[model samples]
Structure formats: structure tokens, C-alpha cells
Target: MNVKQWMLVVCFLCSGTKYIPNTCRTFGSGVVQPFQGSGFYVRSNCPFTLTRLTHNRVECDVSIRRGKNGLLVQVEIIINKVRTVLQNGNILVEDQSVSLPYDHTYENIFQYGIYTRLRSSLLPLTVTWHTVPAGIDTLWVRTAIFIRKS
Candidate 1:
């Protein structure tokens, strides 16, 4: 197929995909790796934080406007943590390290489900995305966090 035709085909297939627990904007702290963070739905412009409702210090006075990137996940982090989320699904806790552009705009460099889960270290969070595991699991959080150490 040509570039235009290929683009349409890609969009059609991607539209069917959704983000797990990609709704919550004002999310609390802590990890919901076990609970799957929440549920998935059609993608939107809102950002997602991998915080569970049951964690302490849940209510964060996070000024989203100050978020270096267009995502709050990066804002919540004070510094860079040992690059959370290993290639094998391990998470580095309390790692403040975040990598993102200073601009508040987002770019879909990997809209085709590149990462199983989004890491705090990454910025301009993937608002509209689909992970490979979501196909086999309904309670899957496309951008879920992992508590276990690598």
C-alpha cells in the first residue's frame, strides 16, 4: 500500500486499541503493579499516573503546568531514578530520573505498542496507546507500574 493508504490502515487498527487505567489524571503515589493500576478505554489527551487509590499521600498538589513534559508522571518525579522499568518488566522505586522534552507537546514516536508499560523516566506520556499484553488480558494496565525490583 502507498503511504496514505498505509496510514489509514494503521489508524484503523490502532483505533481499536486502548490504554488500561489511562483515565486517572489526579492519581496518588505508590505502585499498582499487582492491581493493574485500573482499567483501559479509548485513548484521549489526558495523562495517567500509576498510583493506586489506596496509597498514602495520594492527593498531590501537582501543578501540571510545571510538568517539564506534557505528562504528570514526569512531574511527580523529583529526580531521575535508576531508569525505572527494565526491558524485562522490573521497576526502580522512588527513582526520580525523568527524561523528556521541555516542551508541553507530545509526539507519537511509538504508537504501535512499543513498551508494555510507560515509565516515569519517559515523558510526554503515551495518552493513546495499545500494548501487546492487553489483547490477552482485560485487566491489563497498558501503562501500569511495576514494584518488583529488577
Candidate 2:
């Protein structure tokens, strides 16, 4: 093969064309009572310019099992004031579905759902949670943010 052809192959091999998230970060909030009327709480947040995060994964877990309904959790990505739901991120069980440790202490259970497209809103991107668990279960939420540069 010629030098130029070899160089082209090497470059292509070095940098694959597949779009991969360049920055991946995980953040969590302190213990919170989702069943309360507090509504949504921020789990992870980051600032972006023209380029924005394209995917997110949410994790929910609780230490106590206070009711039969289990903890119903919903994951949302809020860019500025707009909200986008990560499908399958809404979990019913606290530890089983979310796959968190089965202990009396709070833990973070991550279950990545389908990837969703997101656009920048000239503000910081935030991952929030809303729950319908009627119990007084103490919960801790975590979110993973995957970002790509435009």
C-alpha cells in the first residue's frame, strides 16, 4: 500500500467514526424523601455551551420498605426549563428493579434506559427525579451524564 493510503487507514482506525460520549460523569444528591410533596430534586447537573448532553441514566434506591406499592420513581432530564423523560428510567421497586443493595442504609442503584436526544438550552443540564412512593422511605438518587462535543 502507498504511504498516503496507509496513513488514511491508520487515522481511521485511531479515531472511529462512531459517536461516543466524550465526557461521562456521575453525581448524586443527599438522602431525600421522594414521597413527600417536594416534587423534583436535582441529582446531577452540568453546564454546556452550544453542544449539549445527549444521553442520561438514572438510579434510585431506598433503605426502607414501608408500603406494598414499592417506590415508584421517575427520571427526568431538565435543560433550562424543558424536561425530557428517559424511557424505562421510571422504576417501581426500590432495590429489586433498580438493583440496589438490600440493606438498611441508603444506596444508589443505576439502571440506564433508552438513549434520548437532547439539545442545548443556553443553561446547565440537570437530572431530576419525581416519585409516587406513598411510603415514608428515605431515598437517594443518582444520575449519569454522557456528553458529546458538537
The sequence of per-residue lDDT tens digits that candidate 2 reaches over residues 39-126 is 3333322221112333333222212222223332233334333333322343333223432221222222232242222223232222
41-80: candidate 1 lDDT, tens digit per residue: 3222343443323223322211111122222223222212
TM match of model 2 to true structure: 0.19
Best lDDT goes to which candidate? 2
Where's the lowest-lDDT run of ten residues in candidate 2?
58-67
Off by over 4 Å in 1: 1-21, 27-75, 78-150
Q: Which sections of candidate 2 miss by over 4 Å?
A: 1-24, 27-73, 89-115, 121-150
The per-residue C-alpha lDDT of model 2 at residue 87 equals 27
